[model samples]
Target: MSYEGSFRVWRGDDDAGGLVDYQVEVNDGEVVLDVIHRLQATQAPDLAVRWNCKAGKCGSCSAEVNGRPRLLCMTRMSTFSPDEVVTVTPLRTFPVLRDLVTDVSFNYEKAREIPAFEPPKGVAPGDYRMAQVDVGRSQEFRKCIECFLCQDVCHVIRDHEQNKPAFAGPRFFIRIAELDMHPLDTREGRAEAAQDEHGLGLCNITKCCTEVCPEGIKITDNGIIPMKERVVDRKYDPLVWLGSKIFRRQT
Candidate 1:
């Protein structure tokens, strides 16, 4: 049976906007993005939907499907009843550029703030060895495609817009944690960076960021929690304090 539905896509430039409904026909196994293309070709020539590598690898084509942040190409039309109207909107966390497009410059700016990796002296180019198990720990974070779905779903930036300035969001926390856990990383001040106003403390461990992560990065459990632990140990661990005092006297 052929399925047909109406998609009420958000349309317009930065100056104005409104929902414009487009009727589309679909076959079994077709995705919402496929239907969107049909609408663009036939109904609305000026419609805009950002996308690349429709196979869900590029992480573009990310938008709020029925108010949920998801990759449209990965979302099948079968999930909803044929009679239902699917509403596609831009990610709510950032300023919209135009219909279904948002200016994600904020994330780029945050990325620039993170310190680059500075490995220890003993770690040679190819000689920086790490156990496979230890290497596996940070590998999950490496799968991130920069979709920003986690950022879109985070209440720290969504519901509480005021926190955006000081909150680095979950993605960067994962980066920090990954580098901090790197065996060769001899850089100091990670604990301070994680505990800074725009760091781990901003994450309330709501796990919303984890839930929206397409790569399945355990943001709260692996990244944020461990970072918090490191911060606590640095500030309050008795042994660290004692060792610091003893080392200072010896020097």
Candidate 2:
């Protein structure tokens, strides 16, 4: 069975825009993206939306639904009643290019800031080995689909545009965290990078990023918090500092 659903889709470019309401037919087992597709086909022929692999893997359909960061393709229409008015808007953290499509180049800039993974010097590609426990930690973080939903919800950059210069947000924290935790990655100074350079201190553990993650990655608790603790331990704890100094002197 299908019914009419009202959608308040923000329509315009970076300069200005507002919610343009559209009444569309909702179908069984359809998602928010489906409603948007209907809108493109019927009411608003000029409506522009970016989506791929409508199965929710591509993370291209990132948007704010009812004021929450979500993947439009993953959000089931059945979650809302037939009469409930759904609101879909471009990610507020970034400039909108057109209707429902935001210029997410900020995330690309942040991605470039993260240093690439560095394997141990002696470990060639064929000889690389990792314990199951270490592999487990990095594996969890590698699941991120680059949705930027985490980046969009992070208040450090969300509310304060100035923070963009410093903050890489939760998504890249996952990237850094994975590299830092990887057994094969012998690179040092990631803890410092996460704290001093990437604005880890700006995160007050709101867990907003974790809540919106489609991958169910424990971004705040597992990645950000652990990285924060590691940073603090390396920076403030006398034992780790002394150990590092002793190791350096011996070498």
Candidate 3:
């Protein structure tokens, strides 16, 4: 069965915008993206929304549904009552390019700031090997689709625009955690970079990034917290500090 749904969609560009109400037809098993598509087809031909592979893996459809970051294609319409005025808005953390689409280039800049995976010097591409446990650990982080919902929800950049320059946010934190955990990776001082450079200290363990993840990746527990612990241990532990000094001297 289908019903008429009330949707309040934000429309306009960076300089001006407001939520424009629309009464649209909602169908069974349909998602918010579908309704937005309906709006594009019926009423608002100029409505701007970014989406691809509506199956939820592409992460292109990132937006705020009633102020919560979410992939519009994955948010089922059934979650809301028929009469509820579902509000769809652009991700607030980023600048609005237009209706329901924000300039997410901030995430790309953060991605570029992260160092790439460096394999051991002697290990050839085919010869590199890792234990099952290590492979499993890395695989979990590889599941990130780069949705930026985590970044959008992160308060460091969300609330304080000034913090954007210093903070790489949770998405890159997990990336650093992944590389730091790599058994064959030769890069050193990753934890230091995370803390001193990427603004890891600003996190405060809020876990807001983990809450909105569509993939259910334990971003806070599995990635950020462990990295924080490593940072603490490396900075404060006497033995680790001594070992680092000795290693540097020997090298």
Candidate 4:
């Protein structure tokens, strides 16, 4: 169950870099992160890899395995043929800090933009109660480990860095969707921001984000698309549009 394999790990920093190949030992039940760790131990101790917990919980080991976004600690070495060369690279959407480590601060900036949940007026902490179904829906999004794989795979910003400023990407879309769907949250303007500010309209219903999710969140169908529908309902619902025109107060 042990064999010699190869890995092409990108080596360098923000200024410049390239894929540096290395021959390494592979064993049964080991994941890609294991191979990378082995390379560090014996061959490339200076190799920079950002990993914590090695359990896929911290999500700090996110990288591109053969150009697809994945959690390195979760990708089984057995999934590849014994002699196949596995190429590990930093996330393409973000600036690389070093080998296998990219700057994920974009996600944090997007996270800060999402408004926190606010209860309806007169509602207090003691009065907080959510239906089981609503609570279940919100809980599913909370399962996200902040891996940002969804954001990395999202084509809106993956190929075009210029779009990054306007796009919230899939991860924060889930956050916005969760708050908008929460029955007890009194927050308004999330649906509006999703369309105008967050660029929810850019998504064309491709579920690439859901595919790479270690948590298996139904990011497109359950979160993005539903949020898109709500945004549409708010903007173009004829009855509401007419009601706004007729009933809007004049200063």
**Backbone atom clashes (below 3 Å) for every candidate:** 0, 0, 0, 0
| TM-score winner between candidates 1 and 3 | 3
Better of 2 and 3 by lDDT: 3
The local distance difference test score of each candidate is 0.85, 0.90, 0.92, 0.90
Task: Give candidate 2 regions above 4 Å deviation.
Answer: 246-251
Ranking of all predicted structures according to lDDT, beginning with the best and ending with the worst: 3, 2, 4, 1
Error of 2 at 61 (Å): 0.1
For candidate 4, the TM-score is: 0.93
TM-score per candidate, in order? 0.92, 0.95, 0.95, 0.93
Tens digit per residue, CA lDDT, model 1, 37-114: 888898887888899999888988889999899988989999999899999999989999989889988999999888
Lowest lDDT sum, 10 consecutive residues, model 2, at 242-251
Pairs with steric clashes in candidate 3 = none
Residues 186-218 of candidate 2 have per-residue lDDT tens digits of 788998989999988899999999999999999
lDDT of 4 at 216: 93
Q: Write the per-residue lDDT of candidate 4 for residues 115-199, one digit (tens) a residue.
A: 8888989988899987797678878898999989999999999988889889999999999988888888877788999999999
Q: How close is each model in CA RMSD to the real structure? A: 2.8, 2.0, 2.2, 3.2
lDDT of model 3, residue 193:
95
- Model 3: residues with Cα > 4 Å off, grouped in runs: 243-251
